[model samples]
Target chain A: MTKKQTCIFLIIVAAVIAALITGIVLTDGLYERDATIQETMQDVVLHERDKISLFGLAVNPGLISAFIVTGVILVFAAIVRIFVIPKFKLIPGKFQMLLEQAVGAFGGLARSNSPHKNGFLGAYIFAAGAYIFIGTLFELVGVPAVTAAGECVILPAPLSDINGAITLGCLSYLVILSGGIAANRLRGAGRTLKEFSLPVSMSFRMFGALLSGALVTELVYSYLALSFVLPVIVGVLFTVLHAIIQAYVLTMLTSLFYGEVSEPYVKKPKKQREKKVSSKTEVVQ
Target chain B: MPLQLAAVPLNIDWQQILLHLLNFVILFAGLWLLLYKPVRSFMQKRREHYEKMDADAEKKQAEAEKARAEYEEKLAGAEQEIASQRRAAELQAEEYGARQRREAEELAKSILAEARADAARIRAQAEKDARADVAAIVTDAVEKLALKESASTAYDQFLAAVDAQSAASKKPAKGARTEKDHD
Candidate 1:
């Protein structure tokens, strides 16, 4: 669809989802009971049930429902594209236009990297993978679903634990692995697979470090249990750090991929010399 | 205290945690398939469209610049032509003025020569007329003197002759009368 249409669609979908999540959080007894129980426990949970609201929509909130809903929507869109539209030989009209524009951009990026070879597949894979990774992280954090409930979402229970730290590290490693694979596939001459791995590794390392720091800080401060100000401060600090790390990781990976794809076309002097010598010998003969 | 602490058993829901984790993974996959891909694609398309427009605009700008230079060159050529024409006109005017001046000088010279010739003819005629008049006057004066001298001489001679004749006749008459008186 046209950009405006797509945006509108997203907004409408988001609104509907938000409304649904809000209804679920407010009307459903599960989230409220869970919050009360957790409060009674006074355990090592990183966030208080009372302080968290879904953008102020929920009296008490759970983000799991929102994540599930958004996930369903995504899967639904993919299914529609694959089955209904593709089978009928029907174009998505404005939606196709939007898709084409995206394709062209990725195509351009690919072309820039590998003028000789097609980089479209690589770009597509990378873009798709990145989205999946970010979405997964967001789901894990329960942000989108939390936003739906109008609550200030925090990382869920196990993620704040020591075990959670290890889980996140494993997830980071998976992301790095995927990134490395994509880089390798896209890589051209003059670039080693190792070169691509560097950025992927760095991204994971940085993510790990940030997560570690945040977890340690939360454990030490017990800020989530304190007054509202302390929690806000800690949240802001963690978010900023997280955002910086994420941005760095994304940028480095993109650069590495671009470099890998474009490297082959750059001719070495020895090749030039060989060609020149062959041509001269031909002329002389 | 030990008995009271031991009496509270821990209740952990591993199933719920696993379900949530599974849900999170599924949600992430779904989002990647749908929203993120499309949004990114849209942005990329927008970027490409703008880049194409920019390149086209740059090409048009270069063409406009070339056209302007060509127009300026033509204008310079026209200016040069006008300048050359002006010089030619000036030269023509100079030549025309010189021809007019030369014609005027030649006319003046011819006029002066005619005037000089006319003056000389008049002077010559006047001199000729004056010479004839002087000759006539001299002749008239000479004739008048000659006539006066001749008249005086003729008068003197006639008087002398008459005196002689009277003298002779008187002597005769006296002699004859005396003879007659004597007779």
Candidate 2:
């Protein structure tokens, strides 16, 4: 599949999962009655055992909140991309330097495989795939939702929270699509899907490992009556560790791909000498 | 367990719902306009700039390699030319040495011939001078012997008698002796 299609698929899957979880959590208390309503309406009502199911089909507040939060995050990401990034001139600063190192490392990998002509584009496509894959993972984990608010909505099974899922899904899809399209257009035929796939696959594997580790750690933490601060600290530490692992995996995979692609183009002295000899013989003949 | 069916009258809040929907739409639209577009564009621009730089660097590297190859080729050619020139100079020096050697040999041969000619001429001249001296000595000796023998013979005696008579009448009979000596 193209990078765009893959990104869309990931985003859609993540959003659906998140929305289902949120919807279940939100509707958990829908059937519960308020004790105050029974006491106040006892004298006024003719039937004492009657009950009411008000707001039966009303949209869950949590779902709306989650959607609002996602929208806000999108806006924030946009602002950073357009205004903050441009203002800071991220190309010359530490971030830009870091990006350059990343690009160089990936480019080297591509060059190793094919040729110098293809390495640059190959690295770019690789980076785009990775960024989108990680973004989808983060979105599914509800990191952006958590950042927006401390709490999120939960969903029940059997009923799909279509609106919540589709909205967030579309947003995630757009972000990934934009990145992928830009990469493809910029790199053109020079970029190879295989080159990009290596990093993407490696990154996903690393992310899965890190996530498993985090889950294990959290499970251990759950056993302890740890303070709020301790849990926060542990969570932050795990996140940082996960990020580091993912970054390393990305770098290693990119370098490997670049190396594989560029090997053919690198001129060997022995080969050049042989060529020269052959040409001379031909000339003489 | 008895299933208790219950129904209650619901109060609808259309205004509140409408207000919330409006709020959501406005907030979403506003945020989308303000934040998402700019950030994405900036990221795209950043990515483009880096890619362009990468391509430029590769092109520059290729150009440098081409130039280096050209320089090495030129240098090799120059070295070969210099080697040929050196070989030619060596051959020229060899030819010059050979010519000088030939000239020296010719000069030495001419000198030797001249010396031999001079010795031969000197020997011939000495032999000629010795023969002439011997011939002159022999002629002188023969002439001396002939005169002495003839004087001892008859003719020598007659010449002696005439010489004695002329010597005896030489003082008083000069006029008369001229006629008598003629008879």
Candidate 3:
């Protein structure tokens, strides 16, 4: 063989041997390490414990995950701002193109739906959507975290918590209300008030969707038969699907309702001709 | 109760609500500065640059078109001037030719009249000279005839005298009388 081909072949062989040795050393005579995953989950009896206290309130597992998710989003935002934003060209790079497409899609959604074209709703929806999608996926990362009762469990999706869902739902409702009021003043408030249960419905939807995914993964992990290869697949599929679907459902509903309530109120002529014709017909009959 | 607890997935937690609400507020501000503002400004600047370039190209094209039109008009005007000049030259040549013909005709007529006058004078002079020579010749011939007749008469008279003297010696006196009676 040629000298370069021999060298590459030797390098690949060496890498495989080194990986096998390292795996053996790490296992330390345990050939089946993954088998204990189901047993550990069974013995632990996993449950969310609200223990972290501040100002007479208990910060639950969902809040802890929410804090971590928020930090992740903030750091990502900072990196894109500092390094990526300044280097954006007219013909965008891949990362820049993705960002532009994302923002443009959401902005276009807002513009197409909104009557007066509120700017903050689009920005707010983008942030909220990112939070919901990424927060859902964050649970799949399996970050070891302690609950208030000092019991350890994997991180949870923030929206799986009813409180976080309520907050986001109410916030979205407030944004829609503000948009309507800004576009149509007192009439806008009346329109928004007409849909009062919107927040409750939105919150329950988000909470239910993420909670179901979590429970299913939890159940799968706690069992021995399905825990081997199935938990990973099930967890990832449910998380990703729920993340994408819930994000879309929330953003679509907000923008659509925002569009509806924010429409300008035009006074109609008091049905003069139609009412007179109807009245004359009724009298003749 | 155990199955019911297992079935329930959500419960109220006030702290997460407030925390998430605050987190969302921070996230919204951050995303606005990082994503929306800068990208939009870049796009705006690019659009304006393209529009400016288009306007500049259009302006230059219009100017060039105007210059070509002016050049074509000037060329047409020069062609018209050249045609006018050529026609004027032709007319000038025709007038010059007419003037030369008139001069030539006048000169020929005067020369012919002068030659006719000269021939008439020369003919009259020749006639006068011939008439003088004929008169002189006639006068000389008349004088010579008279002289000859006179001499013959004298000679006859002398001979008659001699004959008379001799008749006295013979009969010469009768011949002298006969000679005087000659008609």
lDDT against the true structure, per candidate, is 0.49, 0.46, 0.75
Candidate of highest TM-score = 3
Please identify model 3 stretches exceeding 4 Å from their true place: A1-57, A228-232, A270-284, B1-9, B51-183
Question: What C-alpha lDDT, on a 0 to 100 scale, does residue A214 get in candidate 3?
Answer: 76
TM for every model, in the order presented, reads 0.37, 0.31, 0.66
Per TM-score, what order, best first?
Answer: 3, 1, 2
- Model 3 agreement with the true structure over A1-285: per-residue lDDT tens digits: 999999999999999989977875686555443435555433222233434544555566677788788889888878888898888886788988898888877777788888476578788888888889999999988887654565555767888777788899999999989988888899999999999999999988887787778777867765555755697689887789999999999998999989988898888677987899899999999
Comparing to the true complex, what docking class would candidate 1 get?
Answer: incorrect
Worst 10 residues of 1 chain A by lDDT: A57-66
Could you give candidate 1's fraction of true interface contacts? Answer: 0.11
Q: What is the lDDT of candidate 2?
A: 0.46
lDDT tens per residue, model 1, A1-285: 799999999999999989977875576554333333335334333223322333443212223432434455566568755664343212346765555554455455545644444433334333433333343244234342243334444543223232232323334334434443444544432244445455445434543554454455445343223524564555556554554455335434453454454444445789889999999999999
DockQ scores for all the models shown?
Answer: 0.05, 0.05, 0.32
Error of 3 at B170 (Å): 73
In order, the candidates keep a fraction of the true contacts of 0.11, 0.12, 0.68
Interface Cα RMSD, each model: 7.5, 11.1, 2.9
